[model samples]
Target: MNVSLQIRDVPGEVRDAIAALAAANGQSMQGYLLELVRREARVARNRTLFDRLAGKRVRGLVVDDIVTTIRRGRDDPDRADPDVA
Candidate 1:
């Protein structure tokens, strides 16, 4: 389900600028505004996720070190597996 949104008392210059941008992009004002809202929502969600992850530590598991180890194994398949023994 979707709800309607209404904004009141937009200044003329701002409205005209947005209208012009919408027209230039071959979209109706509604379509352009809807895309803006959706993009902003995605950005907000990403920000919230990053905020939740901030300052949390995983002991002895550096991401760069892991990637390097994987790459080394891929590049040299004859290398002994550290976890095998």
Candidate 2:
């Protein structure tokens, strides 16, 4: 499948640089952009790195939670085990 995009107001110098970089990477400008899109899509689907943060609330953390988790990890050796209760 092929998609067409229209990019406007691109400075000539920047466009030349992008074209040179893409050529160095063995891709046309369009191919480079498409590859970048595909990579980002795959990474998003993997949901391992930064994708786990989607639609989550994290503004309510206090100092107690931090200290508690640290203490628990240090105090309990078996807490991280899944097969043992």
Top candidate when judged by lDDT against the true structure: 1
The CA lDDT of each predicted structure is 0.93, 0.84
lDDT measured at residue 61 in model 1 versus the true structure, 0 to 100: 90
Q: What TM value does model 1 have?
A: 0.70
lDDT over C-alpha atoms for residue 5 of model 2: 73
State the lDDT of candidate 1 residue by residue for 1-85, as single tens digits. Answer: 8989999999999999999999999999999999999999999999998888875756789889999988988789788777897
What is the C-alpha local distance difference test score of candidate 2? Answer: 0.84
**Which residue pairs clash within candidate 1?**
none
Q: Stretches of candidate 2 above 4 Å error?
A: 47-85
Q: What is the TM-score of each predicted model, taking all chains together?
A: 0.70, 0.45
* Alpha-carbon deviation at 30 in model 1, angstroms: 0.3
lDDT of 1 at 43: 100
What RMSD, rounded to one decimal, does every model reach? Answer: 5.5, 6.2
Model 2 scores a TM of: 0.45
Off by over 4 Å in 1: 57-64, 71-85
